[model samples]
Every structure is written in C-alpha cells, then in structure tokens.
Target: MAAELMDGKLLAQEMKEELKAQVEELKSKGITPGLGVILVGDNPASKSYVTSKEKACERIGIFSDDTRLPDTITEEELLSHVDRMNRDDKIHGILVQLPLPKHIDEDKIINAISPDKDVDGFHPVSVGRMVLGQETFLPCTPHGCLKLLERYDVETEGAEVVVIGRSNIVGKPVANLLMRKDKPGNSTVTVCHTRTKKEDLLTHTKKADIIIVASGFPNTLTADMVKDGVVVIDVGINRVEDASRERGYRLIGDADFDSLKEKCSKITPVPGGVGPMTITMLLFNTVQSARNRLSK
Candidate 1:
C-alpha cells in the first residue's frame, strides 16, 4: 500500500478554525492580536510569501502592519523600522522577511527585534528558549513539522529519527524539538548534513523510523535510504524547470515522493505540505504573543 499523505493544508485549515475562535475571544476581552511584518526587498518569492501571510492574518481577524522597503535600504534604516514595530502597543508579533539585500546585515536585524515580538522566532533569545524547552515562540517551519507529526500520531517517543539538514531555521531547531523531554519528543535524533560521508549518511538513514529532510536540494532522500513503514517529512522546496508547465517550473521536496511513497508509511507532499503549515504556525505564534500581552 502507498504511504498515506499527511495533508498539511487540511490540518492548517483546522488549526485556523481554532485560531479564529481564539481571536474572537481575545477581541471580546478587548485585545486584537496584531502582527508587524517587514519585507526589506522586492524579491518575487518573498513578496508572495508576505502576501500569503497577510491574507492569513486577515482571514483570522488578526491585525497586520506591513512595511515594504526598497532593496537599497541600509541596515540602520531597517533597524529603525524594527525598533518602531517593537514599541507599537498594538503589534504583538514582528516578522522580518528573510533573504534581505546583500548590503544589509541579517543577523544584526534579527537581533534587533525584541524577543517578545519575534514572531518569526529567529531572534537569539527565542533560539535559546527553544533549546531550553521553555515556553517561547518556536520557529514556524520546525513547529509546523512537529505539529504534523503529533497530529498524525507518528509515535515519536524513543524513535530513531534522522534529520537530513542542520540549518538553524528548520533542521537544528526541529532536531532539538524532537529530542526534548516532552510529548512528541524524547526521540533519538541524528542530524545528517553535507559533511557526513555518503556511507555514514546511509547508515544513519537506514535505521531511522522517522526522517525530516530540509536540505534545500531536490531528491536528497529516496526510498532505499529509509526503512519500511517510516514516517517522512520533506521540508525542502526547490524549483525544477519544466517546460511543459506555464510557470516553466514546478516545486519538489527533498524526498523522492514517488519512490518513497511506495516504501514509507507516511509523507508530506510539496506545495501543499509543509508550506501551508508554516504560514499557519506563524499566525499561531502571533496569536499566542498577543495573548501573552493580555496576561501581562
């Protein structure tokens, strides 16, 4: 039998329905959850992502303050905008779109945002809190992946899980989350990366009951690499040129879904998989941040 599709789009809709009720209740209590979004350049993909986030915020009745800046803006100018958002009483969560212009310092900008309002959860404080397993904003993509595993009953406890990337954003954070001493955690995680020898990589993957691949490269994981009945989360999204399509390209994940589907017990598809959940979780963090403000 083919692997069951872990439909993130459906789950995101369900989560949004729950969030709508939470937002309504917060409004009844005189608190409107607000998100301040900053986009530093006009990269088409980044713009599209930001637009989706704004739409998601609107759908759930959360306030969004969007700032679109030119590619020429200096690091100092961007920092000023971040500082402005930090002090905005109505804005509970702040998100700065990634891949800023070459001239700007990404780390400095991320560090400038207040941890309390770092909805993207890229700030150092948030990372530290996540490592410590404290209640803090979890990185959206990683958080979404973990949520999918939990909702789908993936049996993470003590599972041999291999994560195929080590980036701070998805791989590292998700690995940390999986090993935490908590439900949906307590799994033994081995993270494979570019540095891992080919044989060593296979050795780790062959025994993994669960694998989360986020290497940003297509076909990083295949059917032969994972065990039968494995649960796979494909986090990589790479565009491959396809002349037959109108857009001239298609999105694919790191895992070879066709081959892997026949072997693995479960998997998440590209485009409709982790992508939707990432945005939904961003909205989740924003709502949670607003609720925190209300309690303060």
Candidate 2:
C-alpha cells in the first residue's frame, strides 16, 4: 500500500482557524496582534512569500505592517527600521525575511529585533530558550513539522529518527526539538549533513522510524535509502526545470516522493507539505506573543 499523505495544507487550515478564534478573543479584550515584516531588495520569491504572510494576517484579523526597501539599502538603514519596529507598541511580532541583500549583515539585523517580538525566532535568545526547553518562540518550520507529526498521531516517543540536514533553521533545531525530554520528543535523533559518509546516511535512515530530509536537493532521498514504514517529512524546496509547466519549472523536495512513498508509512508532499505549515506557525507565534504581552 502507498504511504498515507501527511496533509500539511489541511492541518494548517485547522490551526489557522484556531488562531482566528484566538485573534477574535484578543481583539475583544482590546488586544490586536500585529506582525511587522521587513523586506529588502526585489527577489520575486521573497516578495511572493511576504504577500502570502500578509494575507494570512488579514484572515486572522491581525494587523500587518510591511516595510520594503531597495536593494541598495545599507545594513545600518535596515537596523534602524528593525529598531523602530522593536519599540512599536502596536507591533507584537517582527520578522525580517531571510536571504537579505548582499550589502546587509543578516546576523546584526536578526539581533536587532527584541526577543519578545522576534516572531521569526532567529535571535540567539530564542535559540537559547529553545535549547533550554523554555517558553519562547519556536522556529516556524521545525515547529510546523513537529505539529504535523502530532496531528497525524505518529509515534515519536522512543522512535529512532534520522534528520538529513544540519542548518540552524530546520535540521539542527528540529533535532533539538525531537531530542527534548517531552511528548512528541524523547526520540533518538541522528542529524546527518554533507560531511557524513554516504554509507552512514543509508545506515541511519534505514533504521529510522521517522526521517526528515531538508537538504534542498531534489530527489536526495531515494526509495532504497529509507526503511519500510518510516514516516518521512520532506523539508527541502527545490525548483527543477520542467518543460511542461507554464513557468518551465516545478517545486520538488529532497525525497523522491513518487518512488519513496510506496516504501513509507506516511510522507509529506513538497508544495502542500511543510510550506503551508511554516506560515501558519508564524501566525501562531504572533498570537502567542500578543497573549503573553497581555498576561504580563
């Protein structure tokens, strides 16, 4: 039998509905969650992502402020804008889109956001809090992946999980999350990256009850590499040339879904998979930020 689809789009919609209800409650209590997005340069993909985020905010009844700067913008100018958002009482969450213009210092820009308002959860403080398993904003993508597992009722406790990527954003944080001593966590995790031997990748993946691939390379995880009945989460988003498509390209994940799906118990699709959940988690984090502020 083919693997059951992990419907991230459906789960995201459910979470968004919950957030919308919470947003309404907050509004009734005189609290309106606001998200500030800082975009630099004119990368078409980044522009499209920002637009989608803004639309999500509108749906949830949250206020969204978008700051778009030219490609020529300097690091100092970007920092200035982040600083302003940090102090803006109306804005509870501040997200500076990644892949900043070459001229700007991305680390410095991420550091500029107040920890309380770092909805993107890229700051060191947020990372540190996550490490300690404290209540802080969880990085959206990894958080979303975990949520997907929970919604699907996948068995995580004591399971051997292999995550193929080591980036701070998805791979490492996800490993940290799964290794945590908590529910949906407490699993044995092995994170593999480029330096890892090819034999090691197969060795670990073959034994993994859950495998997450985030290497941004199309078809990186072949069907033969994974064990039967493994739950696969494909976090990679790669654009490959497709002559048939109108744009001459299509989105694909690291896993060879067509071949690997038959070998797995559950798996997520590329476009409708981890992608939607990332945005929904962003809205969830913003709602939490607003609620925390009100409680304080």
TM-scores of all models? 0.99, 0.99
List, residue by residue over 162-228, the lDDT tens digit for candidate 2.
Answer: 9999999999999999999877899999999999999988899889999999997888799999878
Candidate 2 segments whose C-alpha is farther than 4 A from its true place: none
Can you give the lDDT of residue 58 in candidate 2?
98
In order, the Cα lDDT scores of the candidates are 0.94, 0.94
TM-score of model number 2? 0.99
Question: What is the overall TM-score of model 1 with all chains considered together?
Answer: 0.99
Candidate 1: Cα lDDT at 111: 97
lDDT score, candidate 2: 0.94
| RMSD (CA, Å), each prediction | 0.8, 0.7
True-structure lDDT of candidate 1: 0.94
**Model 1, 237-258: lDDT tens per residue?**
8999999999999999999999
- Which ranges of candidate 1 are over 4 A from the true structure? none
